[model samples]
Target: MVKYLDTPGGFVTKAAASLTLDAGCEFGGGVDCGSQYFLGFMAYHRAWFLQDRLALTVGGGAITNPGRYLVLLPPINGTTAASGTPYFTANPGDRYRAWDFQVAADVIPRPFITFRVEFNHRAANVPYFSGPGGVTPPGGNQGAPGSLVDGWSPDLVKTENRLTGALMVKL
Candidate 1:
């Protein structure tokens, strides 16, 4: 699953984190990949109707947040000791998610251009990754140490929700 932790338009990162939850100088030095901040997302679109002179377009999507249960938040939230190395938790994990939708209305004002206005509710597939790891056997709960690393998408982000209004010139 992926999680956000940045700006509003971007993924929700530790920056968007509630300052009150901060553990302070001793508690992981301001870290909060805290065990309660997981998320996910999905999106799709289509046209509803159109006039005799032009066609119309429409679409929407969702953010899937299973819930957050990370023992770590972000490196930026950490102090000097916090490096690429992640901190450990004493329990299992959880996930988080939220959703947003969108709609669009546009028309061919002339043969060469199509002017449109769009209204949309934007949300993202919160960019986070989680995969159980360790040398233990598949069914061994009491095996050696394991890990769940959280980081950005090595490739493209999962998805997003945003309102975009523009002119299409078919020249």
Candidate 2:
């Protein structure tokens, strides 16, 4: 479960928790990318490959973005005078991205092994943090600030498509 909020327009933002665990093939540990909004359903990707070095290979997969999570916050309040509390606040009911498609490719090293490559494209969701203004929180009216408020927004959520490659050997 990932929970974060972007600032209004581009004022202040906060990303509290983004937890994920794959639990790989042998219960070792699958692939985990922390967490982030997908914009539309055409964001985020996950795949598998079995290759070596020579044999050419190709495959296809799909994508499903969780959606954008945005929020806005004021500065300093989690403390008293100079320092007291050291935690941030993230508004709820943030935006969520949609799901998209994914592509795959690979290079075979040996008959028994091969290499892999993948490319992913995520749609763009609304810019959560821009600079707080007429935009209101999802839950209707903007929530009230805590005793202390101190933070920054416009925190860019990076989902730049990536070029993946790999090398494998056969026994």
Candidate 3:
């Protein structure tokens, strides 16, 4: 279940929880028998000043998954959710945990337009995020779509920090 609420004072809150039950499969198909659960929560507060021309937002969230069933697999060598890669696999009982904090400042020149800059810091218990080398292999993909090459591997890290800027327009 998931819930979101908009409270007074320009605050927004979100919470989510989920349960997944998988029965063991026959003929080596499907997920193993186990129960997986996830919980997450986040709160954001936005305050505007200078007669609503400038706004700032700050928020952070954390999540935990014991089985890593809902975690997103990095696209190494053009891997997809359906076509999983051999380099890494999230089996049953594997844990995946992550949290992120972000802050954004926006310049609202007009009601329909916004110029924003954001900075985020995210971390995980394991090497899950892409690193400086990125998740791609050398010389692009080879052999099978997501199959391992001769001696190349994806670059994954445990933490990530990024700054981004964007222009948003509403019509």
Top candidate on lDDT is: 3
Candidate 2 per-residue lDDT, tens place, 40-118, comes to 1112222223312222223222232331123223232222333322232331223343223346555554566666676
- Which regions of candidate 2 deviate over 4 angstroms? 1-91, 127-159, 169-171
- What is the overall TM-score of model 1 with all chains considered together? 0.32
Write down the TM-score for model 2: 0.32
**Model 3 regions more than 4 Å off:** 1-35
The candidate 2 region of ten consecutive residues with least summed lDDT is 19-28
Q: Quote each prediction's TM-score.
A: 0.32, 0.32, 0.78
Compose the digit string of candidate 3's lDDT tens values, residues 1-171: 333433334432222233333332212244443445565666666666665677777888888776666777788888888888776676766777788998999988998999999999999999888899887778787776678877778889999999999999999
Q: State the RMSD for candidate 1.
A: 17.4
- What value of lDDT does candidate 2 attain over all alpha carbons? 0.34
**Which of 1 and 2 is ahead in lDDT?**
1
